[model samples]
Target: MVKKYRNFKEVGDAVVIYSDNYINDIEGEKLEDLCASYMERGFTSIVIDFSETDLVNSIGVSILIGIIEKVRDCKARIAFSGLKRVNYDIFSIVGLTKHIEIFDTEEDAVNGRVPQEMVTS
Candidate 1:
């Protein structure tokens, strides 16, 4: 099961997405759909939480990359939080972190405590 923790703040114009399993194929799709739904509702910012999720596959990685592209195309922004060391290393190797903003906490990610960038690949 995929669980989400979210906080929508008017001032920040952000939505935080918390997930315990960050990389299940079905869950990843659900998260993507959820983000798209929010984008349709005028949300311009996003934060993804992955501290509890320690596993990922190519499909999962692809989903995340897709999210980054979609948000960028819309001129919106996104941050990631609670990344486990293993997943973080994978993301780093892929250069996803270089482009996608990441925070150690949900608050920081959603509140603009981090700088935004583009995906390297």
Candidate 2:
């Protein structure tokens, strides 16, 4: 079974998924499935890049929660990068920040380094 989600690249032990411009239920589910598949294949680090993502609806956010849980259950690490400022603030306010680290660039996410200014306890 070959499934394709927007786009993705594997970096060493990490897999980076590039999200769609508009993340609705359909695209969100595709992202989830692709990430889950990679986890099943033994990817210990995952990064979902939102550089291209302009907006994500409520359903998309709900789906993201599921993906976050799945990553935890798989005992893998996950991060998000390239989020537009508004989207990043929305995610932070929605409490996704509690579960995942957000970065300004894919390189930072792949490197697993969140800028100090963005860090919050």
Candidate 3:
């Protein structure tokens, strides 16, 4: 399926981006552009809610990496929430977990509550 770029919502200082069921090469650029816009707007925190995203290809991972770079450039914090087990593994394998905090739910991510199980040394 052709994925489209969904709109994001603002939660205080954070901007939350909701994802579709799948993230592929097509959605990557859109995500990047959306994040860039948010950064331009002076948003310091970003949360990517993947509650509906069940699959993420290599291109999608690369896209996320690009987003991470943009967030880092602005010295902003970014978090990921609602990731499935498989998707979590993908993020772990790609070293995203080292930079972005992962949460089991959007509320937890937004509230900055990292699940005890997800906390790493």
Give me the candidate number with maximum lDDT.
Answer: 2
* TM-score per candidate, chains pooled: 0.82, 0.85, 0.83
RMSD of 2: 4.9
lDDT of 3: 0.80
Clashes of each: 2, 0, 0
- Model 2 clash pairs are none
- Candidate order by lDDT, decreasing, is 2, 3, 1
Best by TM-score: 2
Q: Residue 66, candidate 2: how far off, in angstroms?
A: 0.5
| Candidate 3 lDDT trough over 10 residues, lowest sum | 112-121
User: Following a full C-alpha superposition, what root-mean-square deviation does model 1 have from the true structure?
Assistant: 4.7
Score each candidate by Cα lDDT: 0.75, 0.84, 0.80
Better of 2 and 3 by TM-score: 2
lDDT of 2 by residue, 32-88 (tens): 999999999998888999999999888899999899888877767889999998788
Residue lDDT tens for model 1, 25-89: 89789889988987898888887878768787778889999998998888788888888889899
lDDT of 1: 0.75
TM-score, predicted candidate 1 vs. hidden true structure: 0.82
